[model samples]
Structures are given as structure tokens and as C-alpha cells.
Target: MHLPEIRRSHIAIAVISGLLFSLSFRLNQYFDALFVYSAGISLLFLPAGVKLLAVLVGRLPAIVGIMVVSVHLGASIWPDKPMTAIVYFAFVSLMTYPIATLGVMRLFHIRKNLSNLRYHHIVVLSVVASILNGLVHNWLYLAQGVTTSEELWHKSAAMALGDFMGCFVVVAFFHAAMGVLRSARNPQID
Candidate 1:
């Protein structure tokens, strides 16, 4: 219900989802077993680190987005299969990161005080983070000889769409979670 409680719930959900997804991939042979294992590790640790940094820096959402992007970048560079690496990075940065960051932001009502200037700032930060995330993944794939310029452009477009979709899902989840928490915290009033 409170900020701390909400944070815990988010972390728990993220962890559970990450684990379930990784296990599913492993079971279905969607990825290399090692890759799926590594992804699971990253999902558990990277977001937690990002959230801590964000909280300490007092720019929670933006910093979390950046760190999530950084995680994707690192993952992209570590894989032998460039396409797989790029896809993984895209999923995490463009899909998971945006959703998680937006969820936390909306849950806390962080945009309540936004003026046009502040709104612009938030949008700019999110866009920058998303672009940087896509570029990093694309660059990795290019460096690994996995994709040409045309393919890179296509992937970039997909990355952008993933980011938008992620943001939408995360924001919606935040709203739902916040409502649930609010009700739990104030059952008598409700």
C-alpha cells in the first residue's frame, strides 16, 4: 500500500515472471540452456541494481530505464549468436524495461506534478533510453556480422514498437496494482 510495500510487490512479481519465462524457454528449447540461465540471472539482478541506483539518485524511472538498457547492451555483447543476442536485448530493453519503469512511475503518481516542461523531460528521457537500447543491440549484431543495414533498420522499428508496447503494459499494470494496494490499505473506507 505504501511506497515500500509497492516496491516489494513489484520486485517479487518481476522476479517470479523472469523465472517462469526463463524456465519456459529452457523447457521448450527456445534458447540455449546457458543463455536462458544467464538471462534468468540478469533478470533477477539487473533490475534490482537499477532500482537501487534510481532510488539513490532520486530519478528512479529514468535511471532504471538506463540501467535496463545497459543490461541489454551487456547481454548483446556476450552472446555467440548475434541474432539471438539482439532478440534477447530487445525483449529486455524494449519490452521488460519500459514496462517495469513505467509501472513504478505511474504507481507512485510521479507525473502528478508534471508541467509541460516536466512532461517533455520524461518523454525525452524515455525516448533516449529506448533509442540507445536499440542502437546498442543493433550495433552488437552488426559487429558480430549477423545483420545488414536493412535488417538493422527493420529490427530497430520492431524495437521501437516493443518499447511502446512495454510502456503501455507497464503503465496499465501500475494502475491496477495501485488500485489493489489502495483498496487493501483502506478496506474500511472503501
Candidate 2:
């Protein structure tokens, strides 16, 4: 595709991904009693998976969408938080996927296109991403006095578990969908 076409497609992808992220966030809120673990953590944060998938497929531009939605949602989610804290968490959310992707890619020597990616790779990435995300975000929250040191580890674990479950669910569904597509494209005669 030409530069303009590529840009348009990337923009479209980012918008769609952002919408999906927003929807997931709303759904998580709807089931807040079941999914939420703390002020900023969910027991099943589907947006974490959406963020990962967007970066995996859409590259850097995906961050734009995720960041925008994150900031917007962060304000409403934690209205008492200062704008700086909201922005800070938004950035942390944006950084999570790229950091995880780069680390996983470098460690595994996986290709950028992820053509050689496997379920194990995804699992590893999810774990690394979730841990890093939970730690960094909670650390920042602690620094900002949003969370107490006593609650740090518990909050971090909650966040990590939520992110991991979200990533797992999304990746599993994507894998199954791809399998169905592949089978449809090359069906066997009985």
C-alpha cells in the first residue's frame, strides 16, 4: 500500500481498537463487583488484551488510540486523581505492550510480523507484560501516594492476574477464530 493508504488503514485500525478497548472497559465496569479488585485494578481486565492485540497487529499507532482512551477513561474511573496521575497511568498503559513485545521478541528472536509466533510465545509475553504492568503501575501509584506500601503487593498481584486472564481469553479466541478461517479456506472432503 502507498503511504497515504497505509496511514489511513493504520488510523482505521487504531480507531477500531480504541472502540473495542472502550467497550471492554465499560463491560468491566458493568461487572465491577465481580471483576474489580481495587481502585485501579480489575480481576479480568480485557482492555489489557485489547491493548496487546492492537500493538501486535497495528504497531505504534495503536498506542495513540489506547492512550487516548486510557486518559479519557482514567479521568472518569479515578475522578479524584490529579490530571498528572491520570496522564502518568495512561502512559504506563501505552508502554506495557511495546515493552513486552520487544522483550519477548528479543528473548525469543521472533520476527516482527510474528509469523513464527506460537501459543507459548503469547503466554510468555502475557506473563511478562502483566507483571511489568502491574508492578510499574502500582509503583507509580505508591509514589503518588495513591496506594499504601502495605497494599502494594496485593494490588500488583491482582493487576497481574487480571491482565493475564484478559490476555489469555483474547488470544485463545483469536487462535480459534484463525483456525476456523484456515479450515474454511482449505476444507477436506469427507
Looking at candidate 2, the ten consecutive residues that score lowest on lDDT are 170-179
Output the number of the lDDT-best candidate.
2
Candidate 2 segments whose C-alpha is farther than 4 A from its true place = 1-3, 188-190
Clash totals for all models, in order?
A: 0, 0
The global Cα lDDT (0 to 1) of model 1 is 0.44
Cα lDDT over the full model 2: 0.84
- The runs of at least 3 residues in candidate 1 whose Cα sits more than 4 Å from the true structure, single-residue gaps closed, are 1-128, 187-190
Cα-based lDDT for every prediction = 0.44, 0.84
Residue 104, model 1: Cα distance from true site in angstroms: 12
